[model samples]
Target: MAEDFDLVKIMESGLEGAEYNKAKFPGLVYRIQNPKAAFLIFTSGKVVCTGSKSVENAHKAIITLANTLKDIGFDKIDLDPEVHVQNIVATADLKTNLNLNTIVMALGMENVEYEPEVFPGLVYRIDAPKLVVLIFSSGKLVIAGGKIPEDCEEGLRIISTEFDNLGLLS
Candidate 1:
């Protein structure tokens, strides 16, 4: 449910902490420090907020932004709008270096992509939680494409268990 927003009005208002450069980016960038989040406000009234450490923090930041907008004369701003989380990213360590070759073989070729020339890390996809995990030789793993925190945790558990069952973890 997006509406047409007056980008020129917002920019001409000379707001304290908002930057808009249409030639560079079509959205107005508004940032807040408390939750360490940045939002991209589009003329279509769609706001893309990122960099919040947790879902709660993201909600807080959005509410704050909505309030600020209302105060700044955007009366159309909804104080209790429906929020949708795109994805959640999480990281972990295996405590031991992984052999990409072994992982590729054990995990199967379909859900795993490890091309050393193209990418240094192996891309492992999980179906249950619908996540993509990046496995590196240094034992560091980055899990992404999760809808919620629990999805991330579940994906990690699935991966760790797979490696553990195969005697891959030391």
Candidate 2:
């Protein structure tokens, strides 16, 4: 997290597509169109970048922002800043229909939350990878909260293994 940023100067720099409304939100929303990422820049110099599918893309986005800040006369801006991956989202397909009721019973009530009336997907919390996997009846899955791509892969493997062992996969 970068610290001690001059948010006011950044806002005054006439950054194209930069939205800063202190009354609406505390942070400035800077949209980087090239890498296709939105950065939530705070007065404290802390930036939260989202919409990046990979770490490389996130890093590139930050670099682009840093360059823009430098070009706008922002002092002490780090050109090569350290980028941290806080979360990763991934999707997968089981290639077969799944029964939410049976999955809930098999995975246990504590780990599974299936409410078709409210949502069609079953929310499965995996403790090992520390991620949440959304299992759908259409055999599609969405894994989120992973710090790395490997975490998503591991979470998928664990869930697939568990489902396979229980004969849940068709």
Candidate 3:
């Protein structure tokens, strides 16, 4: 059984502690790296915790860490309530190279957008809020936005299933 750790209390205390020593600890508290990256570290006693890199990866890593702790018989210990995500990479690759324009045409451009920059790619804002379909010129496909790790896993599984059904891998 998961311990009932009041996340709110932990967050409030952590913020207070972090704010109290902001001068000595740069990037110790809440610091946004960009629109999609960040770092978070908060220590409460022996639980020295750190999570950085895209929000998605951070959550996954933290959950895995928590499970490991629990498995090691630290069920009574509550991890810090605040979840930190520092990086989120969105990319994908299909067995067959897909044309961005063609895919957009099939999916309709109303819900999708494309951009040009350091990492130029097309972004598909599907109906699902927690899901994003990213297509790149290098034949890399990325699926990001699964709020829960299971959701991400499901998404990948569904992709793989579809690929199998269509013999895309063969």
Candidate No. with top lDDT: 2
Using all chains and alpha carbons, the TM-scores for the candidates as numbered come to 0.92, 0.91, 0.44
Which portions of model 3 show Cα errors greater than 4 Å?
A: 1-26, 29-39, 42-91, 116-119, 154-170
Error of 2 at 23 (Å): 1.4
Question: Model 2, range 1-170, lDDT digits (tens) per residue?
Answer: 45677777788889988998889999999998888999999988889999987888999999999999888987678999878889999999999999888888877899888889999999999998899999998999999999989999999999999999999876
Clashes of 3: 14
lDDT of each prediction vs. the true structure?
0.88, 0.90, 0.49
lDDT string for model 3 (9-126, tens) is 4445433333324456522343222232223333432222333444555555555545534554555654644553322334445656655665556556776786555447777654
Q: After superposition, how far is residue 91 of candidate 3 from its true place, in Å?
A: 5.1
- Per-residue lDDT tens digits of candidate 1, residues 1-170? 14887777877777668898899999999889987799899999999889899999999899988887887788888897788999888899888998999999887899999999999999998888789999999999999998899998998899889999999999
Off by over 4 Å in 2: none
Ranking by TM-score: 1, 2, 3
Native RMSD of candidate 3 (Å): 9.7
> Which has the higher lDDT value, candidate number 1 or candidate number 3?
1
**Looking at candidate 1, what is the lDDT of residue 63?**
90
Clashing pairs in 1: none
Q: What C-alpha lDDT, on a 0 to 100 scale, does residue 19 get in candidate 2?
A: 90
